[model samples]
Target: MRIPQIRLESTKAQIGLKTINAVNNIKQPKADLSIEQPKAELTIRTTPSKLTIDQTQARADVDLKSVVKRMEEFSQKGYQDLLAGIARRAQQGIELMKIENGGNPIATQAKQNSQKPMKEFGLGFIPSHGSVKISYEPARVDIEVAPNKPKIHVNVNKPIMEYEPGKVEVSLKQKNELNIDFEMIDIKA
Candidate 1:
């Protein structure tokens, strides 16, 4: 029997920063400056698998400690910005789904038109003065049945930000069915 290979793909993973307001900036005579950093955290969980087979046979988990370290080196704003962007995108998806689900065309059109710009507003920007951008390559994983092994790869893209602090984490999992090949024989020759 031969085992087939399985592979899965995921969209680019991104993390966002939270807005940091400058409270008080003090400079000592020695050219040392002290500022207050905001306390904000963002947590993002991928949607659970909808398939019953997947729910029982497949599982994937991410280590928050490692993710936090990567995020710390990657983005200061943390995960808030990414969450906001995802939320906006999800809202857009829900609206579109409603339109496709036999909702009123005229009302859907009107809602879409009114919501487009508002959705864009959710992705706030930052100034470049004191803001930092952190990015990481996308992460991928492959599973093979013949070898009964799983391979993982991590890559980070360049982080882009104007002037905010944020963080991001990504995870993925998949299931596959194995097919066996056989030849049919004549029953009564």
Candidate 2:
């Protein structure tokens, strides 16, 4: 009689690994600023000088009143006195012609002869005097000045940063291969 044989077969599982790298990102923005400036101020003022003059004394140097009076005295000649004497003599002659006390003709003639010629004497004096004067005033000046300062302003913004946390992933791509097999065969006689 021949004996019978039995057979067995088996297979093992496999494992695989996959890797990924982490990534990081960062970003920042710039800051801002502002400024302003002003101009300066100034002022100035002035006054002019003045002068004055007077001339009262210089005008009275040459006067002519006394000279004119002396000239008039020479031109009249005594005509006034001659007329008076003639009238008196005529009166005495009329008295004599009237046969009154033999007429005092001789006495009248003597009185006329005794009388003085012309009237008024001496001349009047003229006036002349004084001097000149001058005066002056000084000038004045004033000045003022003021200065200005500039203004400045600034503003800064905080840096804006964006960050992504690093990430890592682990996965199996190909499983580790492991195989096992069992087999049995029958013999012939």
- Candidate 2 C-alpha lDDT tens digits along 158-184: 665555555555555545554544445
- Stretches of candidate 1 off by over 4 Å are 1-78, 100-189
* Model 2: how far residue 16 lies from native, Å: 7.7
Q: Which candidate is the best by lDDT?
A: 2
CA lDDT scores, all candidates in order: 0.47, 0.57
Model 1 scores worst on lDDT over the 10 consecutive residues at 52-61
Deviation (Å) of 119 in candidate 2: 36
**Residue 89 lDDT (model 1):** 71
Question: Against the true structure, whose TM-score is highest?
Answer: 2
Predicted candidate 1 versus true structure: per-residue lDDT over 107-156, tens digit per residue: 65566557746344444333322233333444444433332233444444
